[model samples]
Target: MSTTEEPTQGTTISVTEQAAEEAIALLEGESMDTDIAGLRLYVQQGGCAGLSYGMRFDNEPEEDDTIFEHHGLRVFVDPASMNYIEGSVLDYEGGLQGEGFHVENPNVVSECGCGESFRT
Candidate 1:
């Protein structure tokens, strides 16, 4: 597992060390199993950028993929989706504004006004 900072210009892409650490902390207290391994981040066809982000807790990984570790949290990305989400960050933000997990993707060329969809 390696930890490094990869920066980008738009939407503050690239998952930061702090974000990963926070993810782990939240997961630990969610009443779920702490042995969840890590999160799987991917891009699927749909949404307003012709592309959309997908995330889930997964224990198994496919044969060819990149696994990144930040503050003991592991994040997995499949090769196929990597091209679309190369410089994106996976963040968990909570507050009255709207508490939920969000993706800050720089590759997004246009997004739906609702902010639930994007096109790139």
Candidate 2:
């Protein structure tokens, strides 16, 4: 995996090459620009399962966030959600059922049926 040093941060955010490649491919077909800059992974409360994962393409990093690189892709994680997502893998899966990005979160204790939410 490739690594990038954040100009003013100490923590490193890691992303797998497979995840990066999949993100790039998906973004290329979207109305958004392919120059993703990086992806932002965060967690928020309020889902039916108690918590939800929020992701977005971000070109800038927050003051308290850590940045990292993998397979030529950049990943950003907020300080608040970092601990919950640490060691988790981000992947894109597709089949006759559906296609989307899924997070294999070790911290997750349970998930709701809709798959849009989870809890630790």
Candidate 3:
């Protein structure tokens, strides 16, 4: 993976305030019926560009997962995916155009035209 900024010193990823708040809101909504723990962020081998990002609400972390608590929200990242997403900043954006969680990954060398996939 190519990186523009220096990789994070000790962690795999960084979570932004907006992303943290959005994640917490989703978790809280689901927590009304069940106990929710955190969100998991990982990369999978797929997509037109060869890599795709994935996220899901998780009740617990795996043995090899790296966890980060940011702005009162917990985020989990698996060991293998961590290498491709290291130094990435997770953020949430809203506007007239669109609104969603976005990954500002310095490691991305190129991205698909659809913007749903990337290559290192």
Could you say which candidate leads in TM-score? 3
- Give me the overall lDDT of model 2: 0.72
Candidate that would win on lDDT: 3
The full ranking of all candidates by TM-score, starting with the best, is 3, 2, 1
Q: What does candidate 3's lDDT look like per residue over 3-102, in tens digits?
A: 3233457555778898888888888888721223788899998999999999988887776677777787777788789989878889999999799999
Identify the runs in model 2 with alpha carbons over 4 angstroms from their true place. Answer: 1-14, 26-36
Model 2, C-alpha of 22: deviation from truth (Å): 2.5
TM-score of each: 0.72, 0.77, 0.86
Candidates 2 and 3: which is better by TM-score? 3
Q: What is the C-alpha lDDT of each candidate?
A: 0.66, 0.72, 0.81
Candidate RMSDs in Å, in order, are 4.8, 4.4, 5.6
What is the per-residue lDDT of model 2 for residues 1-120, given as tens digits with 9 covering 90 to 100? 123455344344456667788877655555445444678889999779988998988765677676666776667787788767776778777889887778888778889998889988
The candidate, 2 or 3, that scores higher on lDDT is 3
